[model samples]
Target chain A: MFFYLIDVFGTMAFAISGVLTAINKKMDPFGVFVIAFVTAVGGGTLRDVLIGRSPVGWMRDLNYVYVIIAGFFLAVIFRKKLDKLRTSLFFFDTIGLGVFTLIGLEKGLEINLHPVICVALGTMTACFGGVTRDILCNEIPVIFRKEIYATICILGGCVFFLLKALHVPDGLLYILTSGVIIATRLMAVVFKWSLPPLSRD
Target chain B: MFFYLIDVFGTMAFAISGVLTAINKKMDPFGVFVIAFVTAVGGGTLRDVLIGRSPVGWMRDLNYVYVIIAGFFLAVIFRKKLDKLRTSLFFFDTIGLGVFTLIGLEKGLEINLHPVICVALGTMTACFGGVTRDILCNEIPVIFRKEIYATICILGGCVFFLLKALHVPDGLLYILTSGVIIATRLMAVVFKWSLPPLSRD
Candidate 1:
């Protein structure tokens, strides 16, 4: 039940990001909704496929469609409001990264996947949607070059696994892992930090 | 032996499409090769997951890496010559699409997927690279527009299954399907034909 809230909120955040990218591109209404839907679910779709989940999540939950459509209009109607706080979008986006990574890690753990694969899965769930949106918007994925995006997800997953190894209580571990991610991401942005680019030859 | 040529040429074709998109974006050499590799192999990777193949292609074969690097430099060197052509890229692109659809169709058949899924895979394999590149370049995919893109792949897939149904010789079927796709795409370009938008309502 707790994780379900995280799932829905993560979806909403991803959907908003997609809608904003569409707006930036001046895509029409239909185009906006399509990108929104794909962005919200694309990462999870890839995750489901990797773990052999048949038919995928949106196929089972019609509400996912409605949520994305609603998010699109919400963005369109609230364009001025959003534009006013364009800076906070980064914070909201980081919160999404935290929630998504935890949800993904829990899912992988449920399936009894190896720890490494679970870490990869959590990272993908948190990052792939933005990557998809960036591609659709013809922008380089910010995660690949921005303030330690995938790195934070990896660290969150590692925290989760460490808590599990210590036999920490599930509820407490959940809070700890997600808190670490959100805090780490926010601090990184506040500090203007990122992994250095690969050295030139 | 013949399939090998088709595979290599298809990779080359997809790589060129990626390079073109990257060049258009003014990406660095590493960035260009990254886009080229993603554009060239993303569809196949998606297909592999759907069909339960592990590790993906590029993770399995370093040859794909070599191809994208080679294609990137080749594009950088030949951009001037390429710019001189009125439609040479389009011509080769059509050929690439045709051959790619055939290979995708053959792979789907090997895995015994449903005919419908097979054709979908064929269209995907032939069109998805450009779609990814376009998305990364922050534009609507050309194929999603009314272009003779996905349509050509569909037409070619139909030719493939039709030839098999008629007990056509294997080599002849390959030639026939590819020829149909190339001819249809070129003809559409010549005629400036397109599918109607879905939202006339």
Candidate 2:
């Protein structure tokens, strides 16, 4: 039940991110909705597809679609106030990332996939929506270019498994894993941590 | 048997296009292979996922991977000669687009989706690999911005259903629909037909 709330919040945060990007790009309403929906669900969809899960997670549940629509309107109505809410938005986005990573990792474990592939799937789930959103908006994906985004998800996945090996209980595992992801992302931002770009030379 | 041959050829053509793009971007060999592989199978994989088909098309068959690898080496080894082969590549690419559109539409029909959604899926299958490649390379997707690429796929899908409703034979339907897509695309290129860009003003 707690995780469900986190999932809804994450979806809304990602949807808002997508809507802001579409608005900034001057996209039509249809394009805005499409981008917003994809941003909230694209990563999970990709993970489900890779793991051979059918109909994807979003298609099976209408709530995601509803949340995305709500998110779009919320962002549009509060566009003027968004700049001031940057910090709050970032916090929500980080929480979303953490929740999404746990969801993805758990899904992978359900299918008995390798730990490494599960970690990769978790990272993909937390990151690919933004990648899809940026692609649709015709910009370089911020995660791919500069950010400690996907890396945090990967690290959190590792932590989840490490704790599992140490016989952590289910509820505590979820909280600890999410806490690790959120804290790591926050520290990365505060420290201006980033991955090095591939050298062109 | 004939459709299988066409699918293989199309995969090769798309892979070549991906390799060329990666080379232009100065990506390393691994990156080039990654881009090429995604370009070859990304669209169909997406379609399969949306329809709840598990393991995707490429994962079930190893031939696609082998073909993509071959395409990568071919493009790399004959880099300088590629300019002279532009016309041939264009022909192959057009054929690939038609075959991929048919494949996607058929897959959708198998799952009993609406014809309109099937058409959209067909367009996604025909164009999205290129879109994914461009996004990974940090460029605007050519299909979304320019030319009549996806338009041709949609038109061909419409033609497919129209002919099917008129009781066209299966073999003849494939030929006629593919011919329509190929001819329309060729004509668009010859006449420089393109969608109007959104005005900045």
Candidate 3:
């Protein structure tokens, strides 16, 4: 039940992020709504499709759709005041990154995928929504260039598997993995750490 | 057997198209290959996932991967002479569009999806590979802005169902649908036909 609430909040955060981006692009309201919907559900949809899970998470559960709609309206209504809520928004987005990675990991493990593939799936689930959003908006994905976003998810997945190998309790394993991802993300931002772009010239 | 050959030919054309785009971007060979692979199979992968087909087409068949590799190497080797092959390239690309749209339509019909949704799927399959290639190269998708590409697919899908209603034989239906799409695309290109961008001002 608690995890479900986190999932909802994460979806809302992702939707608002997409709304902000679409509005920045000066897209029509329809475009903004489409962006919000994809940002909230695209990653999970990709993961489900990869694993042959049909109807996808959002299609089966209308709660995700409702949450995205609510988030879209909230962001549009308070676009001007959104700056004031930046800190809270960042926190929720971080929480979303961690929780989404865990969900992907769980789904992969349920299917008995290789640990390496599971990690890749987890990182993809946590990152690809933003990737798809950026692609649609005609920009290089932030994770591909500037941010340490997907890196954090990959590391979190490693932590998850490492803990499982140690026979850690499932509840504690979830907590530690998410804690690692969230804290590292927060610290990375505070420290202004970023990867240098690859150069072969 | 004939349909499979068309599918392979289409995959090769899409991959080569991706290679050309990536080369224009001055991307590394790995980047070029990634773009080619996605351009070749991304649409079918998305379609398969949407309808719950597992393992995806490429994953289930090694031939798709081999064809993409062959296409990639062929494009790279002939990069300098590619300009002279423009007519040939365009012909193959049009063939790919028609074949891919029919493949998508057939898959959707297999699952008994709504006609409207099936048309959407067909158009998506026909156009999204290039959309993805453009996105990865940090450009707007041509189909979304400047082309009459997907329109051909949608119209062809409508033609397909219309003919089916008249009890067209299955083989004839395939040929007619692809014929409409291919011929229309050729005419659109020859006549420089394009959709006007939406204007709301």
In model 1, what lDDT does residue A155 have? 91
TM-score for each candidate, following the candidate numbering: 0.58, 0.62, 0.62
Model 1: how far residue A131 lies from native, Å: 1.4
Across A2-112, the per-residue lDDT of candidate 1 in tens digits comes to 666666766777888888888889999888888888888887777777676768878999877777777778887897798776666666677778888887787777777
Residue B192 error, candidate 1, Å: 32
TM-score of 1: 0.58
lDDT order of candidates, best first?
3, 2, 1
Superposed by TM-score, candidate 3 places the C-alpha of residue B194 at a distance from the truth, in angstroms, of 20
Give the per-residue lDDT of model 2 (tens digit) for B72-175. Answer: 99999998899899899889999999999998888878876667667878988998899889889987566755677887898999999999999999999999
Colliding residue pairs in candidate 2 = A55-B52
Candidate 1 regions with alpha-carbon error over 4 angstroms: A199-201, B1-44, B50-201
- Tens digit per residue, CA lDDT, model 1, B1-201: 776666676687678777767666655554565578768887777777767775455545566667766776777678667666427666666777888788779879999998888999888888888887777766778888868689888988988898899999999999999999989988898899898888967
What residue runs in model 3 are displaced by over 4 Å at the alpha carbon? B1-52, B57-131, B140-201
Across A58-130, the per-residue lDDT of candidate 3 in tens digits comes to: 9999999999999999999999999899999999999999999999999888877777667867887888899
Candidate 2 runs further than 4 Å off: A1-37, A40-53, A57-131, A138-201
Leading candidate by TM-score? 2
Error of 2 at B78 (Å): 1.8
**How does chain B of model 2 score on TM-score?**
0.98
